[model samples]
Target: MSLKSERRGIHVDQSELLCKKGCGYYGNSAWQGYCSKCWREEYQKARQKQIQEDWELAERLQREEEAAAYGSTAQAPPGAQPLTFSKFEEKKTNEKSRKVTTVKKFFGASRPGAKKVLGGKRRGDAPEAKSGSPSISRQVSLETDRVSKDFVEFLKPFQKPGQDLYKQCKIFLEHMHHKRELSIEEQSEYAQDFYQSVAEKLQTRWKVSPEKVEKAMDQVEKYVMTRLYKYVFCPETTEDEKKDLAVQRRIRALHWVTPQMLCVPVNEEIPEVSDVVVKAITDIIEMDSKRVPREKLCCVTSCSKHIFTAIRTSKEEPASADDFLPTLIYIVLKGNPPRLQSNLQYITRFCNPSRLMSGEDGYYFTNLCCAVAFIEKLDAQSLNLSQEEFDRYMSGQSGPSSSTSSSSLLPRGRESSCPEGSALALVRHNLEAVGQLSRRQERVEREARRLERDLIEWTEGLGREVRGLVQRCPLRLHPGTPASGTPAAPAVAIDSDNLEDPRLPPPLQPQVYAG
Candidate 1:
């Protein structure tokens, strides 16, 4: 190719500078396409074959990248290193999936921790079975509460006619005339239960049915309402007393007497109390001037004063030990201040002022508060204060402080308690120091009820499952299509202990306060 230039020994054209032997022929250049005098014809053929194969592969790869980048039927591995793929693609996909799942969860999907209810198949996820599920047990406890309370108020009067006043109802019923062999005091017993009283009164000339007595009670109720409108309701009180009286009226809406049938005259004059209750209350109240140090003392000041007045009536002597709990409760629940103050002042002026004052610190107020509070705990705990009953009691007073009192407080024990004053000598146990033991009976009862219900359900469920299994597998052989090699036996499960714990109840989940 460089023949003319080489022969003439002259300047060659720049295009003619192909290489030779590691040098340009004139001012030499190395070969680009081939080394000088390169050897085999077969190598050249092989190099050509490799080039064609590599070019085809490169094209195929390019096509694959394009297919991955654009829409294509071929699915890439999730971790495939496609040329066009990026790190964010996988992350973005995952995030979108999570958000969609979350949205589904809130809008009635069965997801954990969702505020709304969700449908699900798992037995544990069934609405009532779920832990911390919404419940109306507390509400049920309230409506049925009347049964328990009425039991307390009325049962004793009938069972123990120690009071001549209540026993007189029998006398009045036997004889049509008001004048009976029994004393006027006997008339009092009829008033003990409004239901009983209605029964006794309606049958003055005839035998009364419980239904008829109920009807009479309905009429008496309206009549009492009219009387309240005319008499007690019309009378003026201090603004606060008016409010309390309204509440007491509500508490006694249908009836006004305690089981004792002692007429708590509406706005009855409060007897002066320089007694133990008053002293205790005064001390408790004075403990903290600013905060009302409510925890330290057993009773509130108002409750304490009322309690002392209730326990020590001017018309009556000091309340017996039997009278203490009820007297305290009545004072706390329904007592008037002015009447109590008037009574207290009367006692101080007429009776010995020194006697009125229990101690120098008391002036009788502090003692009153302590005594009343001591008695309230007593009522919370009785041989009768079953778990269901105490829970019902605690629920009625469900505030923060009330919660603490329910949990941390101890019941008074039998040692400090006086023996029951009934004709029967039932031993009155002292309240536990911490109050928990006192309410144990109630807790146990509630547990028993729950267990009874659960046992019935579990027994029925187990019976059905067992019966089905036994019927289905008559021979206890392979129940399904048998394996060729291994003849599988019908599996029979025998798990007996499926009982749920009565203790450690699921947390009482609160209902959201939606306006």
Candidate 2:
């Protein structure tokens, strides 16, 4: 045959072609086994299928493991994890441990010219450092169960980082939230909101004075500077931390306004709370307050002695300190600049006590106490006064009181127009009386002074008995040595004097349940 025809006609052996003993091939039955290439292809496909199946199985197993592990613990049982974030932490003990802690590891940070983590975090993902503000943000705290915005801000310096740093941070913080030392360059960490809030809580509840409230704020500041900064802690904590504990103290500083403005609601249990709390909510429902013109009303020297007094508080024992927010947000949302009374009221309530104010606060004639007193005195004089007197001295009709220019924005007052010589003379007289009494009382021991209050109480009792006995007879209490009491004992009576009573008697409701 020709060479090409011979090559084409050449045939291979069947056993050689099949190659069954060493390899596995599905269709090649000659060897009764398989070929190496066929076996490799089948093995690869089966391995891939098995891998996919294993992946599904592992995912299912992981879910089950999480369920079993978390069923009995509050460590967020799988699906319930995110729900925990939305729930209120009634008690701090119930909070879960965070997954990662801050540590003082030297990331390429301290190379001398190190900037704050200002550029390493992505803007979309991480919290931005608060810049562009040369003035400090105010801080205020409401209660034990709350965190003021100030506290959150205080945590900022420790948190601010650039995008790249933040992503690395989230990873570095992985599964080990224990404790971390942050490197803040001793910037201002004073929680302005927290301080203001604390002052408000104290003012409305205990009717503490602004100066005393400031003292409390100072106490709280010391606690934060010394204690909170000293160690790493859970984000949520009890009222026991020095800062927290000090702030939690119940005494409230208040405005020299009406009790309704500050002391109106006693506790949540008091049904009046719903009435008071419901007013704001219902006002939104009931009457739509219109945004009236920004009338140029003459400036008034209205103010509050403390933040809480400025807020219209509910009577609930644990007063809802957030009362100021809803009303404020409402006014802002409505695009209506609130009236001076409303504006000053909310502003005084919201402002951090330590941030903007100093010294004795001025009172509006509308101050419930002053109004009541004015009314009683008016009634005592006659059945009624002319509308001019009512508008000039009673209610909130007057532009401002003589004592007002001494408070808030303006400090200059024309020292004239007191019944005796000038308003300053009157103020000086009252202040002098109070100052001498204060000095004399402060000279005694606390316990002895307390006994003196009891003595005053006894005298009050004796006087009451005498008055009752002589109600029908022409008898009276002789003005002899005035009964003395502890510095704090008269606080309640002093508060009682501030109520806005429509009748002739001084309103007797105690401002503070206990000093």
Error at 286, model 2, angstroms? 28
Cα-lDDT of candidate 1: 0.35
TM-score for candidate 2, residues paired by index: 0.14
The lDDT leader among the candidates is 1
For model 2, residues 240-259, the per-residue Cα lDDT tens digits are 13322222221111111222
Worst 10 residues of 2 by lDDT: 290-299
Expressed as tens digits, the lDDT of each residue in 49-149 for candidate 1 is 66676566556655655665655424656766544345334544554455333222221214234122244232222344242424543443343454334
TM-score of each: 0.16, 0.14
- Point out where model 2 deviates above 4 Å: 1-166, 171-179, 182-240, 252-258, 261-515
